[model samples]
Target chain A: MIDPSGWDLPSLTDRWRSATPFGHVAIDDLVARAALDELRQGVSKEPHWPNRGEIFEMMASGPPQQPTPRAFLEALGGPAVRDALAAITGYRLQRVDGNSYVYLAGSYLLPHTDHRPGVDRRIAYVYYLSPEGAFTGGELDLYRCTTDGSGDIVATEIAATLAPRPNRLLLFDVGLTTLHQVREVTGGARISLAGWFY
Target chain B: MLALHRDVLSTDERAQLRATLDAAGWSAHDLADRLHLATANAGADDALFARLLDLANRTTRPLRLRAFQWLRLRRGDYQLLKHDARERPPAAHVELIVDLSAAATGEAELVYTDGGATLFYVPQLPGSVAVIERPPALLRYQRYLCLRVADAEVHRLRLTLA
Candidate 1:
């Protein structure tokens, strides 16, 4: 259900390549209004568990089992969506997988590049589903990195911060320099369907 | 495996050590998302080292101190498991962490894991110490010090023995 008007391959390609700190593009109203509502309702009913680790603390759902979310994910992996993203980002993406994430009060994800050797992840995407004014402080922070001669990250500084606005979709290239994090959710819940385009 | 020794240091001893560390030169270690904390080299404290060594020999095995350091974590600081340098294969060592904070914050914790399952935990309790045996495949990390704990400070004396 991606809007065709905003999917202009030539313009999006330029924007993605020139984005600061790394390659990324943020598109508002990425999907039709009706589909967004259906996806949100379906995701709210899915079972979620507290997923925590050294770098992250948040609630996460497994792969979608409901019809609506399942269908939405399938659509994303289909040729229409995949081809559009491939044209813009220039990554030879073959498939997509996703899960629903809920960042509640005090939840956060520290800075990390989504790069994992041999995992085949090419692009990372987040579709924000939090209603307008539903949350505060859960911004997506991108960091500009200073790497050594060996291409190892040694220092970093905040380059950009994207609010978790409803109906917004963020897609970015994943590599050694794509350092990003989710700022802590201070007040309300920040919900989204996030995963990788592999 | 882990063993907690509560009230290991008296109030005066804790205060003295805190003062010493407070006055020591610290080096900030930052790597974007992996870790952000200050560390300093602590001078040799023979009596305390001997006590910890004796405790470890009694609890786990005979070992000698390899190194020790002072770690200070303020708000918004953390050390992730992936960033721990002790993750080398065939891990064989015992680690001791002595909490020397001015007050107990109960926010930061040292967590040991194996194959993604938690094996041991050490909380930030003033005057308490934790002795943990590092088996092969064992991983450890300090939980993030969140901003909600206003102005809370965590000072830990970490010792490695082999």
Candidate 2:
């Protein structure tokens, strides 16, 4: 569960607006300490499958079937959290859907934008649940893109690298310029809950 | 299906081909969601083409060379499934990929997939050639070259027979 009193909505909104290379913000300790353990336990119990392709290789779980994790997902899509996120990013997010992900050693995701025409995805988010000091080299990398007159990406360069620190939440705009990737996990596993708000 | 032929070229022959390809000009293809690598068109090599044709004919019906190219993937390069060409001749075809790297890194590989399921894999082994049947729905892509393998470079010669 989230603790609204701990959040400074005005400051988060400012940060989101001023962020570079397309809008994004990272919030640490987003979840209430008392509920964190239950959430992690529920996620760990879910079944996962190895999803591999040319651009990515990682373990992904479907929508949580357990009551605790399912309830947490419902809370995320509920009006309170949705309004808070809307205030920060200025996007009218109606609902959210997410799945658990595990990036083990040698796993990676190459650069890509989460944009798709007519998909209606407005914002993307990742909630890091990995244990402290459990992994190395699995950073979320954002890229700065240069687009041509026709609005096609012509070039790109790294703009930011965000560590998957436990209990941190990363939110970014979903658009053509928001190119990003998950760097390869060289050591232990990197676990997280990631999804998009529509 | 996939078949691998080891030591298809002699050491000296492979080295000569590598040297020639190394000297040719290459253009970068940098589409983020699709691919990021260097590609070049090599000069016509009638002898090599004939040899590849003969090799492919052993397993498949008689075919003719349709196209060929050189690919170079350095560290941090990749080719995603979306980049595979969708336009192809209606008849069944085969693809031949000859590895020419100085040494095999084993990180980069060619994978063929259909409906999200992997059908075959081609490892990166120098002096080896992979022959793969190309059906209309089959898609192939080269895996990403990770940066952990310092100075890793993968050079391959790809030929299309239809």
Worst lDDT 10-window in candidate 1 chain A: A1-10
Worst 10 residues of 1 chain B by lDDT: B82-91
Report the C-alpha displacement of residue A80, candidate 2, in angstroms.
1.1
Candidate 2 residue spans exceeding 4 A from truth: A149-151, B1-4, B23-29, B40-46, B57-66, B86-94, B102-107, B114-119, B132-137, B146-152
TM-score of chain A of each: 0.96, 0.96
- Residue-level lDDT of model 2, residues A6-37, one tens digit each, is 67899999999998888899889978776778
Q: How well is each residue in A66-143 modelled by candidate 1, as lDDT tens digits?
A: 887888788778888888887898887899999999989878999988999899889899989888999888899999
Q: Score the docking of each candidate (DockQ).
A: 0.63, 0.44
Question: Which residue pairs in candidate 2 have backbone atoms (N, alpha carbon, C) closer than 3 angstroms, thus clashing?
Answer: none
Shift in Å, residue B141, candidate 1 = 0.8
Error of 2 at B10 (Å): 3.4
Error of 1 at A174 (Å): 1.4
| TM-score for candidate 2 | 0.84
